[model samples]
Target: MSDASVFIAGPASWNQIVLLDRLPDPVPHMQFAEESWETLGGTSAGKALSLRGLGRTLLLYAAAGDDDAGRQVRAALETADVPVHWARSAETERHLNLMTRRGARVSLYLSSPAAQSDRDDAALQAAMKASEVIVLDLAAEPQRLLPLATATGRSIWVDVHDYDGTAEFHRPFLAAADVVFCNADRLDDPLAFLHGCIAAGASLAVCTLGAEGAVAVDAHGVEHRVAAVPVEVVDANGAGDAFFAGVLDARLAGHPVPESLAAGAWAASAVLRSRHLHPLLDPHLG
Candidate 1:
């Protein structure tokens, strides 16, 4: 395994920020002035920033349209020093994400057939074969990549964001992954869900409770808990991803479970203190 090689596959988007006095009771529909647009946000950008700060070689596999947004996305990655093996398709469409000051967020996604299409298995296999670890979004086209990861004998890590009560649909992919990280709000009982994930095949499971802390379970059924670092949180957007990157970095460095969790906790806290999701500015991050 190469010490600096990691693969991340996900959707990238251009974010437009709009500040309001308060989120309207039922959401507003007025066309705002041009000043409402603040900054652009991309999930892949955040992930790449976090991983790159750890001195890891990032390989992002995703689709972006043949538009200005796509050009910006590519340019942003290059600026961040993340290498891209992008699979560009003419049918890709740009995604729009809206961020509000009251901690409410919504996304207007323009879906394209090419963007939703599965990645090439052969290319992914080649990358996985040479990578130290593979980080993926469980919400992505798992059917295409999960099996390939399992077949390649690579350590697979998945980020679980949205769960719609259908465990059956997600079980196969979860079982195939080596590590699973999820936000606490996504589950009813985190410990029970960890056990279920272990039963499904995950060797390690971590549940990140936003402000409270995080809990991690190893393959031997041992549980380790890490308390959240004390900080004034400006935004809670990329804390989980920072935590995931920290954990992976520690594990790749051969740290034990407890130490790994500590590193992750520190990274999460650092991200919480930032106004944005850029992980490179985190003081606690290595």
Candidate 2:
């Protein structure tokens, strides 16, 4: 047991990223690309990696395949000194992400993940019980931990990712989180959605608006706003996760909500300036 303070649970994907001028239309027989790369990507991985980079003790509980991709995922985390307890499945979650210069992305799943039986595992249960913070992502496997998370009285962070506020799968997660992070891509009124989160039980609610900035409502119903930090965006894949990690780290350090939001903006800009999920996460490990 590493006694890590933060616990993250969800999918960890092995992705092939192809940089193109733009995403191809629905019509077939189209091809255009500038470059490509392979990397580890998923909401859980992104958040965990960024938090670790911010100098936090991170413990990740996730599932991956027994294949080479899974090996890569495990090695990357281990090399970064982040302890991970991974359930070995038949195949890892794999994706082919087609991205553009403007950060537009179309991800195609190459292989679907197999069902994993780690929710009831002893090691994962121990980690869950010991961690100071539990971050649950939108995945079927992690839903079982919601009840356990509720029992902890520790902070529970959940990212609803571009929810339209009506998905049945997201309701349990929304209710389980002490803090909720979301993006404004799908909702016409993000502020209303954030307010709804607070009403639903979360003490804090944050909404990230791509290039514009981010806004948050604290437990006292005070709205905090911060503009996005300017950076030359290389890839938009992990910016949201970076933002979430930053705000979480700041809050954990007892920073004010406005200062925490500013920290988030700063972290997100660092991701935008680099091509990887966390710029130093990969090469530093290598």
Candidate 3:
């Protein structure tokens, strides 16, 4: 863990991805999937994979159950060479994601992992204190460990996904985060929200805009934007996570915000061109 520069804590799951021409309408109707497969899921896993692809040294801390699905998830990460410290949970997290070719998705969570013990906390806390940055994805465990994370005083990065800007659950994460990322999916005004985040003391706030690209606001209140790299879309499962990883990696290397955004756009293309969370998972997809 001493070699790891980034420490990530969140959910890691085995997931089934079903692709269709478009997101299924909210109705009871049968539809055939254009393609379907099982692979890794969970925002934290995605970030870990992407960061590994970027040649970054990182340690991932996540909960996994003593179940077959949990074994699959753990094996997959080990195969990808993503170092992880696992916590015992009652069950592994699982999700059924129905996605469109153009990237729209509706995720159905099959199971939520429940921590079985607090034995992993001592090690996780040590890793956090040693890391340069601590990334806490949206999960109950990380949320519960917010105080410890804040105490470390390292840079904290968070991905809120499609935050609507009023959820009580997200406030603590937003408050603890130095850098924040989200998509424009549910927000009525993404730019305004970014501004609000800056006003609230975040060093930076970014909103990804699917194909149009991404936008950001720095601590100085200057806005930055980047055009998405055009690519033959395969799956959008982990693009946002990839983008988050890229930006963090670049920033840590002393790149400016605009350059970091470009790095993020490029990183996302790797996932956009793959069927799995990251290209490193391709050989282990089966």
Candidate 4:
């Protein structure tokens, strides 16, 4: 295997959440308590940070509004040492995100028409051409990125966080992916979905089963199952991103499939034991 440098393109957003021991029957409103907010907690930045900690070079490409959220996101990525190679800064597009706690998520996506019009396709293609792998989150327009995938011939990876039940919207990108990652619960039968993705030309398919474990189907159609490392649970928000980062890193380092799965599981376990997805506490990154 060759060392892989990834370019991630998608929305960068802030995540704010409030934790509760149990869901209120009437959805009680609290004046204030302990709340946590991440300046940059979207999938793209999270994956980039996880990969960076594993010593992989990353080139982040995305559009951000020239506002506070964008500034804060850029500062956070800079602190995490992720390279920003093809970012388009615009006064129009605001950062978008979802807030979640204990498996319940609510999205606050920006659907401004001007945002779509501001995308710089040429710059995105330039960055894709320079990368060994390109990973995109479903938050962006898949149609806009598909041509780049075809033009570069670089490995493409897509993380499906939202499913609309329409095959047309997803099939094109799925067919372009070298690897496709999705939460197990997102599919009715993960094994079946893996098969479909494989038939669509995905070289690798991963379905994360939360605390249970994760399954991966490789290029040759071999299925591998790896259990999550046992750990005291804390937060689950970034577990999937960490696992994906691990798989990408291990593969880039030329590790075998079994070892790669183990590393991915270990990375997720580290996230499970932490309050946040920040990699400073993860021993696996070293």
Candidate 5:
């Protein structure tokens, strides 16, 4: 796998995650005790950092404002020895995530700095072509990379988090990915959607079932299931992305889907025990 490198294209944001006892109701004048901190968040940021913790050869490409938050992101990834290809913007994006200790979350997307889609950049083009795997998330900048990644003949992995199936913006990403992942929280019938992804030309499709675990369908149309590894939940902030990174790392190492799913489960368990993005990856990961 020497020639195989991963390229992640999407959004990276500075997030203030507030952990509460429980998600508050929509009533007037209610308060809950909360613990909060700033961390890196965003589909692209989470996946990229998680992948780095797994010791993959990766280049992360994403848009962020030229601000302190963006600097923090670069410093964190650099300290981990992961290279970044930052797309510049006027301001950085920010998210206010209200999470429950039980792992429930209500994310408020507070800011998005304007970014120009720089698909024509020479370095970006070279990275995409050299990558063995390309991970795309549902951000405008990343979406613009779909066609380019497809042209590279690299394995395209796209995470359509909370896709309800009928979202117009999700269809193109769905059609472009060779491997697909989603969560069961938004879909009325997640299993059906997973099946639909395979039918729509994906070689494999997966749906994370939260506490219920995860499921996948391979290219042969054989379905596989893996239960979540049980662990005392500390913070569930980046668990799903950790799961994806683990599976991706395993798959790149030539593990079968079932084994990869188990690896994903193990990786997710470690993330559940951490307070931030993927601080507890297994030593065996490298």
Candidate 6:
């Protein structure tokens, strides 16, 4: 914990990934999966893996069930040498992700982790206090600890994956964040929203566009853009998280916004070529 550069509070789940030709329509029907497998999946887990890949020290705090699925997630992170503090949950989070070759995904939550107690809250708080950056991903635990995170006055980074800009739940996170990242999938106007985030007090705001690239706005009201590093897409499950990790890592190293965005694009490309969250996890996967 003493060497940890960042503290992350969010989910770490075991996911059954099913590669499909296209996302299924709303009608009730069955379709064959092009391929299927289980692996570690969750936004926080992805960030942890990528951060570790970049040689950044981080401590991840997440809830896990007292079950086999939970153990699988825990073991994978341990093997990756990502230090974690696990809270007991009634059930470990699990997702059935239906993805396509073109990068479309529809995730079905099979199980969601529900923390059984607050026994580890104090420890998480101490870790937050010690770390230079605190990343509060969109999850129940992070939401619960938002006030504490604010009190620490550490730079708080939040990723609101596909925030539509009007979801009540995402508002608090948007407001509390010093740095905010989101995808353009649900945003009607990503650049406008990025500027909005800047206007609302975020030091930096980023919006990722799948193939077109990403756009960002810094506190000085300066807009920056970076094209995606073209790559043969393998799996897009963790690309955004990887980008977030990259940008944060580069910024921590005192790089400016444009350079940091390029760093993020490169990191995302690395994940885009891997089947798992990051290439570092390839050897660890059974």
The C-alpha TM-scores of every prediction are 0.82, 0.94, 0.98, 0.82, 0.93, 0.97
**Model 4 steric clash pairs:** none
Cα-lDDT of candidate 4? 0.68
* lDDT value, candidate 6, whole model: 0.91
Q: List model 5 lDDT by residue over 191-269, tens digit each.
A: 8888888888899999999888999999888999999998998789888888999999999999999999999898888
C-alpha positional error of residue 234 in candidate 4 after TM-score superposition, expressed in Å: 3.0
User: Which predicted model would earn the best lDDT?
Assistant: 3
lDDT of 6 by residue, 1-286 (tens): 4558899989999999999988999999999998888899999999999999999999998888879999999999999999998788888999999999777898899998753356666777788989989999998888888988999889999999999989999999998999999999898899899999999999999999988889999999999999999999988889999999999999999999999999999999999998898888899884
lDDT of 4 by residue, 43-156 (tens): 776788788878888877655666776776676667777777434445323333333344444445443212254356666677677777888776444456777667898888
Question: What's the true lDDT of residue 214 in model 1?
Answer: 88
| Candidate 1: pairs in clash | none
Name the lDDT value of residue 23 in candidate 5.
87
lDDT for each residue of candidate 1 in 34-75, tens digit (9 for 90 to 100): 224423344555666777877768787766667776776666
Best model number under TM-score:
3
List candidate 2 segments past 4 Å from native. Answer: 118-120, 282-286
Better of 1 and 2 by lDDT: 2
Model 5 accuracy (lDDT, Cα): 0.81
Model 3 CA lDDT for position 146: 86
Task: Judge candidate 4 at residue 163 and give its lDDT.
Answer: 46
- lDDT for each of the candidates? 0.67, 0.84, 0.92, 0.68, 0.81, 0.91
Q: Which stretches of candidate 4 lie over 4 Å from their true place?
A: 1-4, 23-34, 86-104, 110-120, 162-168, 280-286
